[model samples]
Structure formats: structure tokens, C-alpha cells
Target: MTQKYRNYDPEFKLYVVKLMELDGHKMTDLSQKLDIPYGNLKRWKTEYRDQKKKEEKEAQNQLLTASEYKEMYEKEKKSNVELQEEVDILKKAMHIFNQEK
Candidate 1:
């Protein structure tokens, strides 16, 4: 007979990752305490780290620094604000027309 594994939520996984990062609990200790497989926990830790690095690299490629991001964000936000104001004005005009009917 095969043993069953339980599903862990995002919070649970995050907790485990924190413990692993802290290095206060050994992998086997965590496995015993959490009733998770030690090998799986190790794999998850490595995958989490690799994913974080990949995401940071992607963010860097997309936007490098805070000032650069703020500049781009401000420009984009200004354009969006103009578009939204135009939309609101059109909506109000449409409402006035509708009410006049």
C-alpha cells in the first residue's frame, strides 16, 4: 500500500521556506515536524530560490532601477490619467444625452 501526501497551501510553503532559510531546522527535522518528505522539501527550497533569481533577472531586464521605474511609471500614469479623464467626460456626456431622452 502507498502512503498518501497532503496538499500544502501557499502560507505553509512560505513557512517552510522561511525555516529552511533560517537554517534553524534540519531538513529531516522539518520533514518529521511537518510530515513532509525531506527530499521534496529540499527540492522545493532549491526551486524557490531559482525561481526568485529568475524573476529578479526578468524584473531587471524590464526595469532596472527605482528612479528609472519611477520615471517610466510617472509617464505611463500621466497618459493613463488623461485617458481616464477623457473616458469620464464621454461617459458624463452620454449620461446627459440619455437623461434628455
Candidate 2:
């Protein structure tokens, strides 16, 4: 007899993890009730938690990048406005000196 293996989809694995979390289901009971191996359930739970942590970390990094870009943009905008004002002042001064000459 050939040993057959069952492949589970991502959705079903996620659902099992959610059931464990939401219902406070014990691993042994869940394994028996769901007709899944205890080791598979444990592995799935670990993978799910790790995946969530990774997603959270990625989100934080993206937010930090966006905020850094915004801060740099604000600084550049302020610097440009100040430089424009200086240029206007210099032009006026030059005009007045030419009129005096």
C-alpha cells in the first residue's frame, strides 16, 4: 500500500489557525475534531503568527518611508520659498541702485 499524503490549501490552514485563536480550541481536541495531525496544526499556528509579524513589520517600514519623504519635502518647500524671497529682495535692490545711478 502506498502512503498517501493530503495537501492543504492556504485558506484552510488560515481557517484552522483562526479557529484555534477565536474558539480557544486545544491542539489535541482540534487535531482530533478536524481530523488533522497535531504536528500540522502546531506548524500552521507558528507559520501564521510569523506571517502576521512579518506583515506588520513591512507596514511599519512603509509608513516610516512615507513620513521621511514628507518631512524632506516640507523642508525643501520651505527652503525654496525663502530663496525666492531673497531673490525678490535682491532684484528690488538692484533696480533702486540702477535708478540712483
Candidate 3:
């Protein structure tokens, strides 16, 4: 008699791994309970960890660094000050022109 091999989907594998983690079950115990090989379960656990790390790195890359934010803030502040100065000069000129009329 030959034993049948089982195929598991990615979602199922991740679910099993998460179940083990949440229940704090040992690989040997979980393998016996779920009818899976201990080595396969271990491999799935490792793959999940690597996937999480990759996702975290990608998320970090999407955010701006502290220095970059500071540089942007400084540029906006300078622009605002220059605009205020121009407005002030225009107001003074208008007042002088009105006085001469």
C-alpha cells in the first residue's frame, strides 16, 4: 500500500502557522494533530518570518526620513516669509500713492 501525498495552499499554510503561534503549540504536537510533517511546518514558519520582514522593509521605504521632512518644512517656511514681505511692500506703496492723490 502507498501513502497519499497532500498539497496545501499558501493561505492554508499561513493559517496553520498562525494557529500554532497563537496557541503556543510545539511543532511536534501540531504536526501530529494536523497530520502534517514536522519539517514542513518548520519550513512554513521560516517562510512566514521572511515574508513579514520583507513587508516591513517595504513599508519603511515608503515613508520620508526625518531629514527629508525637515528640509521640506524649511523650504515652505522661507517661501511664506518672502510672500509676507512682498505683501507688506505693496501695502506701503498703495498707502503712499493714495496720500499723493
Candidate 4:
């Protein structure tokens, strides 16, 4: 049985594959040279392809209507401002009450 080397990160393994591709090296030669299993390279390549497809689909998904988005943002801004004002009022009340001590 072939001896195993230290475990490498999956990300690093993928990076190795990318670099090998860019270098115009043959996959068979790389598999032999890098001591990585051919199956791992094929699986990683497939996973990368599928992930890219999913990302593209998500990016092309429809966004909310401009008016609806604007309305939601304004509501959130108003709520935040109201909360800040209430906090300021409570602080002032506490300061005044403390001064009577």
C-alpha cells in the first residue's frame, strides 16, 4: 500500500488543480506528479462547476420592486430613529433622577 502524506486542505487541493490547469499540464501527469487521486480531481472539478451554476442562478434571481424596497428601508430607518430617541429620553430621566440623590 502507498504511504499517505500529511492531510491537505480541500481549498488548497482545488487551488493546485487550478494552477495545474493554467500551467497547461496534463491531468494524468498532474495526478501522478502531485500524488493526488484522479477521482478527487474529477469530483472537485464537478463540485466547482455545480457551485458556479448555483451562484449564477442566485445572482439572476429577481430582486424586490424598487418601491417596495424603498418603503422597507424607510420603515427600518424610522424604527431605528424612534428607538434612539426613546433611549435618549430614558438617559435624561435617569440623569435628572440621579441629581436628586
lDDT of 1 by residue, 1-101 (tens): 99897788878887898798876778888899888998889887998899899999998798558898799899999999999999999999999999998
TM-score of structure candidate 2: 0.62
Residues 25-59, candidate 4: write the lDDT tens digits: 76678778888887777776677678879998888
Once fitted onto the true fold, the runs of candidate 1 whose alpha carbons sit more than 4 angstroms away are 64-101
Q: Return the TM-score for each candidate structure.
A: 0.55, 0.62, 0.61, 0.55
- Candidate 2: global Cα-lDDT? 0.92
> Mind giving the per-residue lDDT tens digits that candidate 2 earns over 1-101?
99668999999998989989888889899899988999999999999899999999989877757788899999999999999999999999999999998
Q: What TM-score should be assigned to candidate 1? A: 0.55
Q: Taking the tens digit of each residue's C-alpha lDDT, what string does model 3 give over 77-96?
A: 99999999999999999999
Clashing pairs in 4: none
Clashing pairs in 1: none
Report lDDT per candidate. 0.87, 0.92, 0.92, 0.81
